[model samples]
Target chain A: MELFALSDVPEVREGDDLAAIVEDRVDLRADDVLCVASTVVSKADGRTVNLDDVTAGDRARAIAERLEAITGEAKDPRFAQVVLEESNDLVMEAPFILSETRFGHITVNAGIDRSNVPEADLLLLPEDPTGSAERLHEELGVPVVVTDTCGRPFRHGQRGVAIGWAGMPASRDWRGETDRDGRELGVTVESVVDELAAASNLLAGEGDGGTPFVVVREFDFGDHGGSDNLFREYDDDLIRQALQAWEFPG
Target chain B: MELFALSDVPEVREGDDLAAIVEDRVDLRADDVLCVASTVVSKADGRTVNLDDVTAGDRARAIAERLEAITGEAKDPRFAQVVLEESNDLVMEAPFILSETRFGHITVNAGIDRSNVPEADLLLLPEDPTGSAERLHEELGVPVVVTDTCGRPFRHGQRGVAIGWAGMPASRDWRGETDRDGRELGVTVESVVDELAAASNLLAGEGDGGTPFVVVREFDFGDHGGSDNLFREYDDDLIRQALQAWEFPG
Candidate 1:
């Protein structure tokens, strides 16, 4: 698939009609999937948090408390420990970044962020990322993704991942299909959207590049929404169940 | 960057020269970065474990013991409980994969595999993944990555990640640089190799038709080593110190 990174000329902010801004920059071809960085969306919404104003310990504690609220369980101290590690202990009063909510969906900022917001106010992830995607789809008639940066475990750095998707399929399951050698495929579902999101993030680094939107014009799935249609529902419970099933035992 | 997935090959067995086999199928350009799925590598090296042969309870206990051995601490039952919840209580045994190794990296199954391995044998991650990458670099005159599928903490599904890298710069630090708008690019260091690896993995899914090797060409790094010199001796003590600092409450 050929992927093109587009720099949306006009700046975007929360309530700025993201779909309209993107539409004005590029033609929304039916075959193209638009990948957007969440940071831009957050910035446009004026989500900004000042780290210098709070103590690191207090920030960590506050983050832990917010996590507890989202997950409906007291935060695990180990998780808090990991978050502290990722922040290098310099995060005094970090907004809760990302976590699996009580309903089981993965989200950014634990749906919380103060950076990019008007001073002293925080903007959480959209009440429903998929719903947000759907709204964009209705407006633009194309697939849309709201993405964010995430630090992976074991890996030394971070990458962009799809936090919410609409009008596109999240995965492409090829199980029961035949390979070139005619072997029945098993257990090989491809998370195509996430991969594309990561690739696009390379061009749209966290800096102020004005390149928050990525257009993927060429893909193997063709014009049909074979896999993209499956992303209609963002089921948090289903995601949680799947995660619960695959987590490694200690 | 250009990425190509190579597929429709024979099942590799123990003692196979994996690099040579892959080289035979695809021409390696000097700047091409080769990403190989750890499953195929482990399978070629005969890393596999059988679940049907052991009881699930025993498997859970074995895994817990193995985790403790690698971390040099007693396994917390609660943590174990979390793992069991994730693994669906189907774990039969722990393969005693690398733990407390020279690099201080501890992972489940020792980065081993039983899923894609031939029905009888279990596959283990290379003894030293980074060392393996280095050797491949010397032989093929290109960067090499030994990667494996890993589950994310809050996200559903798995993605391929670099467990070891050679001959390619792992990180590109763009911090301190200014954007076109003259904004300081702070903390914008990109894990370019990891992002590329994850992208290539999309075409190298875990199925029959999927290719085990992905050759990525056209990756541009200004002055970093192209493929002949990338590996370095990491200070295990320093890593341990860092881990300790992150682990213990100050």
Candidate 2:
């Protein structure tokens, strides 16, 4: 597979026509998979929330205070409150606040990003990433994957994940398929969308790396569709059991 | 960045000179990062273990019974016993067995694989991935990252992770570094090695695809060293706290 980031893309703002900008900047091909940073999509969708306009609720204030005392992460309670407004549930509150977002994403701070945006505002994930991807796919006439970076449970650093995707299956399921040794494969589904997101980061640097739009070519997915299957419902996941099992001993 | 898997690699076996085989198959350059599947490394190092030789210990048998009852994963008690032998600690026993390997990797089944192997044998991760990476780096004269697929806590499917790496920093520490907008990046260290691992998966299919070695070119790390920092200490991690909080309800 070949990956290249858009070389000349200007700072994105609200209501920007991203499809036009990307088409103008990069040469598109039929089989290319376009990967866009979720921040840019949020900006185009006018999803920015200003902290100054947010007032921390009692819960947000208490959580923010505890977070600040423990990890020194939240300097302003409004930020924590904004995170709360964007979240479906507060998964954790001590070391860091892990929020389960309405999009069924379990991430830190409800995927509210403060970096690479206006200082006073936080950029929440697109209201509907799959919809955004579908719209972009229609406009661009190719596959599109909306991506974001999040910390993982075991690994120390973050890698990109596909928050929204269209025109390709997020995973390649080889459940009943046999391997070269004729052994039946067990639970060996490949998460293709997340891998594409991580590959895009080779050019989409974490900071000041202007290349947010990546075009991946020559990846033969053969026949594929949407990323809906990549998400495990909260009730079906073991993390729920782990959370219910949580008992902070004195 | 450009990626391509070697199309000419023969079926690897124990005691094969993998570096020589890879060098013979593909040309390596200075700036390239070679990501080899840990299975191949294990195969080269003769790390495969047979079920017939392993007798399930009491803990393994009990854990195997619990896992089999919960997820129907462990077909035999020996599989569970092999996983236990490969792990530093048994982090969990319900739904799945999360093993903390000696190499600081928290993965399911202790990174053991029964697929694509000789029947009745299980493939384990390399004994020392960092040392293996270091040796490969010296032999190939290029950056080497040993990769394995592991399930993430939040995501439904697994992604490739760097178990051992050399030649560049596993994480690009941009802490205190200014963004394009002159904002200081906070905890924005990019995990380059892990990204490469994920990128390599574009060519390295999960099941019986035969393409185990991937060469990633044109990626720049500026200046770097090893993958030591990619591992978070058990004491300094929140997952530990989460695991400690795990008190299974009756």
Candidate 3:
């Protein structure tokens, strides 16, 4: 397969038709998979929230004060309020508020993005990343993946994952498939969309590198499994189970 | 950045000079990065262990029996024995053995491979993945990343991660870097090597797809941090801490 980032994607604004912008720079193909950053998708969906309008409730204020008191760093109460507002459940509140987003993603700060937005505005994850990807897939008549960056449980650095996807299987299950030696495969279900997202990161660096759209070609899959199929139910997550089992309260 | 699988990588044998083989297929360049699958690296490094020589110890036998009884599926005692031998710590043994390998990777079955090898042979992770990357870097004079497929804590399906890397920073610490909007980035230290590895998966699917070596060009990073630097200490890992704190014993 071949992967490359699209160039000249202008700074997106709320309600901007991103598919039109992408069509201007990217040559559409039936087999190509378009990987778009969640930040840009959120921007197009008007997911940006102004910190000035955010009212820090008691919990948000308490959390912010605790963070500032512990780290001796400035903590924005409004930012904390936004994080709390976006989160479905607070997993931790000490070093950072490790919370579960409404989308069931476990991320620090509830995927509240502070970069690449106007002053005092924060970009939240798209209300429905899968729906966003579907819309782009419809508009462009190609596969699309909406990606976000997050730190993993044990790994040290962040990589992009498919928060939303269309026109491709998010994962390919090889459970009973035979290996090269004709042995039944074990635990080899491959997450192709996340890999595509991560691969796109090679060009879409975390910095203001300006390139937000990535075109992936030659990815082979028999059928498309909706992106929602990739998510584990809340009760089945190992970390969430362990965290909830803890004596500490959220 | 551009990424594509190598066209002509033969079935690797033990003690083969992989860097030399890669050089024959890939055009070397100063800024280019090569992502080598751990399967190929393990095969080249003679890490393939024959199951015929392995005797299932008591613990391995017990674990295998428990798994078979639970799932009502046949379990390979010899496979379980090899996984036990290769792991540094056994994290869980229910549906499968979730162990931390000596390489500090938390994966199922200790990153063992039963595929792409002769019958009754298994491929273990390289002795030192970072060292292998460094050796390749010294010989080929290009950035190299040793990658493996792994399952994440929350996400379903597997994606590639950097098991070892050289000649480039495993992660780019962009936490203090300014974004396009001139806002300081928070928690944006990106694992670029892992991203590249994940990106490579677009071509390197887990089945008998022959594409293992991925050539990546135009990836930008300033300095090298060594792959070992990205590993979080066992004690400091959030998931490990939570898992160990569980009421159930390992």
Candidates' C-alpha lDDT: 0.56, 0.80, 0.80
Q: What is the clash count for each candidate, in the order shown? A: 37, 3, 1
Alpha-carbon TM-score of each model against the true structure: 0.65, 0.95, 0.90
Model 1, span B1-250: residue lDDT tens:
5677786666777678887888788889987888887766666665544444434465456656776776677754333433343331121233222233233234443444435555553455665677877887888898887776654434544556667788876766665665444655433556766666677776676555457888877665543222222222233122222232231111
> Judged by DockQ cut-offs, is candidate 1 incorrect, acceptable, medium or high?
incorrect
How well is each residue in A26-134 modelled by candidate 2, as lDDT tens digits?
8799989999999899989889888778898998888778767776554688888888888877677556678788887888888887788864467888988988999
What DockQ does each listed candidate score? 0.16, 0.66, 0.63
Give the 10-residue window scoring lowest on summed lDDT in candidate 3 chain A: A220-229
Docking class of 2: medium
* Runs off by more than 4 Å, candidate 1: A14-17, A20-31, A43-127, A172-191, A221-250, B44-106, B178-189, B221-250
Candidate 3 C-alpha lDDT tens digits along B2-119? 6778876788888889988888887777878998998888888889888788999999999999889877999989889989988888877776688888988888899987777763
State which candidate has the highest DockQ.
Answer: 2
Error of 2 at B149 (Å): 1.5
Query: Which prediction has more favorable TM-score, 1 or 2?
Result: 2
Rank all candidate structures by their TM-score, best first, as comma-separated numbers. 2, 3, 1
Question: Model 2 over residues B1-250: C-alpha lDDT tens digits?
Answer: 7898988677788889989988898889887899998988988888888888999889888877876776665457888888888888767756677878888888888988877776347888898999999999999999899998878776677778889998777887767666558776543767888989999977887776799999998888754233458777777666656774574442
